[model samples]
Target: MSYTVNCSILLTDLPLLERPAAAKAAGFDAVEFWWPFAGSVPGDRDVDAFVGALRDAGVQLTGLNFNAGNMPGGDRGLVSWPARSQEFLDNLDVVAAIGERTGCRAFNALYGNRQDGCTPEEQDELGVQNLVRAGRAVQRIGGTVLLEPVSGADAYPLKTARDALGVIAQVRQNGADNIRLLADFYHLAVNGDDVAAVIENHTAEFGHIQIADAPGRNEPGTGELPLQQWISRSRQLGYSGHVGLEYRASQEDPFAWIAAWAHV
Candidate 1:
C-alpha cells in the first residue's frame, strides 16, 4: 500500500514552493492538493508555482481537486447549474493541463450543489453529464477522474460512497470509462456508513482512498475509528492504490504525525 500526504494539511502553512520539499523531507512518496486554482477567488493560491515546486522536489503529484465552488458568488458545486457549465468545463481543461505538466494521474472532480427543488434523479443525471465531460478532458491527458462525494454540509450534494458510485456507474453505462470513485473515510464516518464494507463492495469502482478522523476531522489515530484495522482490511480487499492522509494535525509540526505512521 502506497501512502500520500494531503498537501492541504501537511503543507498548508508553507508557501507552495516549500510544500513539496517539506513533504519529501518528511518521507511522503506523493502529495495532493485541493483546488490550486479558482480564478483568483479569495483563498485561491497560485497553481503554476506550486507545480514548479513539486517538480523540483521530485515528488509525484498523485491527486488534485478541480472544483472549489463558484468564485465571487457564494454558490458551491457545479451540477445542475446550467450557468456554470461552461466555466466548469473550461476549468477542467486548465486543471488537466496542469496534471499533464506535473505528471499527475488522478484528479478529484467534485459534483456541485443539490438545491432544494431538484429531484434526486435529476441531480444524478446532471452530475453524470458534468463528470463525463471532465473525465474526457482528463483521459485526453492520460489521467483519471475520481469523483468525490462531498458531505451535505460541504456541498448539499452526493454525500456517501453510494451516491458517488451511482454517478460513476451512470458514466460507465453511457460508455464513458474514465471516471472512478474516491472513497473518503472522513465523509463516510460522518455520514454513519461502514467504511470497510463500502470499500469491500465497491473495490472495482474505487481508484483512490482518503482518510481523516470524523468529529475532529484530524489524523487517523486521533479519531475513534480503528484506522490501522481499516487499512488492513483495505489491503485484504486488494486495494492497491495509494491511501491519502487528508487530515489536519493537532500538533503544529506535521512531521511528528508522519513519523508515527511511517510503518503504515
Candidate 2:
C-alpha cells in the first residue's frame, strides 16, 4: 500500500507551495490539502503557483477540501451555512478548475456546523442543494464529492459514517450520484464510532480514507488506535486507494512510523 501525504497538516513548517516538493523529498509521490486559499476564488497568480508547485514537485494531487470558511476560527464548513451558500457555490468552479489541471477528482466538502438562527431542517435542505451542485460541477471532470465526519467541534454535526452517508444519500436523491464518504478513521474513532465495523461494512462506500491515531491526533503508534490492524482490515475488504497520512507529526520526521508499517 502507498500513502498520500496530507500537506496541509503534516508539513506545517514549510510554506504551502514548498510542501509538495518536501513531500516528494520525504518519499511521497502524492499529496492532499485543505482549500489552499482564504477566499473562494484566488487570483490567477496564486492558482498558478499552487498548480506549478505540484507539477514541479511531480506529486499527484489526490484530494482537496472545498472552501471551508475560517477553519482556524471554528467555522467547520460552508455547505450548510445559509449565508455562505453562494460562497460555496462560487467555489465549485475554482475547485473544478484545479481538479481539471491536477487530475484530482476527489473533493471533500465539510458540512458546516449547526447555526443559531437556521432550523436543522433548513440547514440540511440547503446542504443537500449545495452538495448536489458541487457534485454536478465536479462531475465535468469525472470527480467524486466527499462528505466527511469531523471530530472535536461540538457545533459540527457530521460525526459518524452514518451521518455522512445519510447526507450522501440525500445528495444522490437530489440527482447527484457522485457524492461519497471520506472515511477518516481518527475523527470517527474520537467520536466513539466503531471504526472497524465502519471499515467492514462501509468499504464499498468510501471514496477516500484518511488516518491519524486517537487520544492525540498524532502519527500512528503514538496512540492506541490499532491503526495497522484497521488498515489491514480495510484492504481485506477491498479498499485499494491510497491511505492519506493526515496526522500532525510529533517528531522532526513525520514519517518515522512508516518504517513500522512497511507491510502496509
Q: What TM-score against the true fold does each predicted structure earn?
A: 0.87, 0.98
125-225: candidate 1 lDDT, tens digit per residue:
77788878877888888888888765536545677888778778888887679888888888787887778788678877778888887678887667687
lDDT of each: 0.75, 0.93
lDDT of 2 by residue, 1-264 (tens): 379999989899989999999999989999999999989999999999999999999999999999999988999999999998899999999999999999999999999999998899999999999999999999999999999999999999899999999999999999999998999999999999999999989999989989999889998999999888888888888888889999989988889888877576
Worst 10 residues of 2 by lDDT: 255-264
What's model 1's lDDT at 47?
Answer: 62
Error of 1 at 262 (Å): 7.3
How much is 45 displaced in model 1, in angstroms?
A: 13
Q: What are the clashing pairs of model 2? A: none
**C-alpha lDDT of residue 78 in model 1:** 67
Compared with the true structure, the alpha-carbon lDDT of candidate 2 equals: 0.93
Cα-based RMSD of the predictions, in order? 3.2, 0.8
Which pairs of residues have clashing backbones in candidate 1?
A: 77-112, 78-112
